[model samples]
Target: MTDDSIYHVDGDLVPASEATVSVDDRGFRYGDAAFETMRAYGGTIFAWGDHLERLERTCEALSLAHGLDASDLRTRIDETLAANDLADASIRLSITRGVQPGKLTPQPEVDPTVVVYANPLPRGGLEGESVWDGPATVETVETRRVPDEALPAAAKTHNYLNGTLARAELEGDADEALMCDREGRLAEGATSNLWFVRDGEVHTPTTDGPVLPGITRRIVLELALEAGVPVREGRYEPADVLAADEAFLTNRTWELRPIATIDGHEIGGGPITARLSRLYDERVEHACYR
Candidate 1:
């Protein structure tokens, strides 16, 4: 980000340094907001329709009806990217249940607060390099994922304390924290989805659990099937990942980052990981750079 970076707040384009929300905003005080982290390649957002669908789902889950249509939000994102003079960038779009009375209960009438910001990133495509230095080092922490029953896992709300505490447990010993479900089944990374390969099969935790259905995760699954790789989604344990031939994590930013080690056990990328990474790059090229 530059000193002159621009941001979209409410419906106005403002300097990032001046973009501020009310102190009494529900999103600030109670984490009452939904947001999406996306990537733009060649000035076009990748998987835009999918991201918009997920954003709508989150808003529906929160019952915070910010009466803006898809085009409205897309225009804001485009304007912000144009204003920043960024083509390949990491974009974050947030919608909050605007300022409300100081109480646990929310009123029926809603005034939503929306913000869009972007930061430059390395170009992404077949010829592009990963944003990460290399494969990530991860550790399984005792902090378990919050059960969907307790808090709807599907909703991408601003309440990230669960992930925050999980990462804090790492204490910088690892690059990412692996969380588990209440039943001790592997969940996901603090902000990414987990995947592993064993006996020529690709396995990941089922999203029916506490795992957030990541956009990259969904695309990778499709790519695997299209490439004729056997895929499985079910409950997994730490030992299962540790014993796998290869391991990796997925998200908008990391893409398909190989896990150099998990719990000090070496489980780096293999042929499958390489193939998947190549396929993901090809997908990006076809979508954004073609």
Candidate 2:
């Protein structure tokens, strides 16, 4: 790792290259971990409270009692950012079920591993520049998302083979892949929540299941309501997405990314998507830099 690159493993700060976990770590052996991807601007983590709340809830759901609390994690993030000398960056904080030998279930009292790292985003001297220059091209991949019955979709666990396989299906076809649920309904993208605008209203899949409750998605809904833009959440099919006037995606790393085309068919002019994108950035600026 470079001089600026450092990672916190457990409670110790070390170079990224020196960071290592045991071979028997549950996170490595069985994907027993919870993680959050966050963004920071001007050295302040955007939507940090929301991210921490989600992380705590996810860990609880996964039965992972990682000792680190929100305040502790926040201080670590600050130290890591200062050590890297980065004002704007993407941060990934993960906690695993710790080390266990050849057992399918982890011991209840096992010490969990906590890891945090930061990577500078493409700000390029302008704080308001878009992460991706334009829109993203998406395609419906063959891999379907695991049903909520099989595994809780709301838990941000390390078991991401579903998304990995779905992304693999888009190897050379599109910028990203959209996965369907077991019932053939539009679920979400590989790593983003899917949303579209139709008839002057915003629509997206309900968070009942089969979709990660994205922090950006939550903020977008709040902003839309504050702006008096009609918002609806429920089950939607591929036909509804294809027939929508405009479409976009949301995630913590890249707040809002408009979709240019889906399965080769172009979406509508991104009037609402553009509005929400601006509103999202405004929210970030107000929350993180004010």
Against the unseen true structure, what C-alpha lDDT does each candidate score? Answer: 0.95, 0.85
Candidate 1's C-alpha runs over 4 A off are none
**Model 2 spans > 4 angstroms off:** 1-4, 123-127, 171-173
- Flag clash pairs in model 2: none
lDDT of 2 at 21: 91
- TM-score of every candidate: 0.98, 0.95
Residue range 1-290, candidate 2, lDDT tens digits: 25648888887889888889998888888899999898878777887888888888888888887777678888888888887888888989888988877889678886888888999885422257777767888999889999988888888989999989998888564778999988899999999999999999999999896998998899999999999999999999899999999999888876888898999899944889988877887777777677
lDDT of 2 at 271: 84
TM-score of 1: 0.98
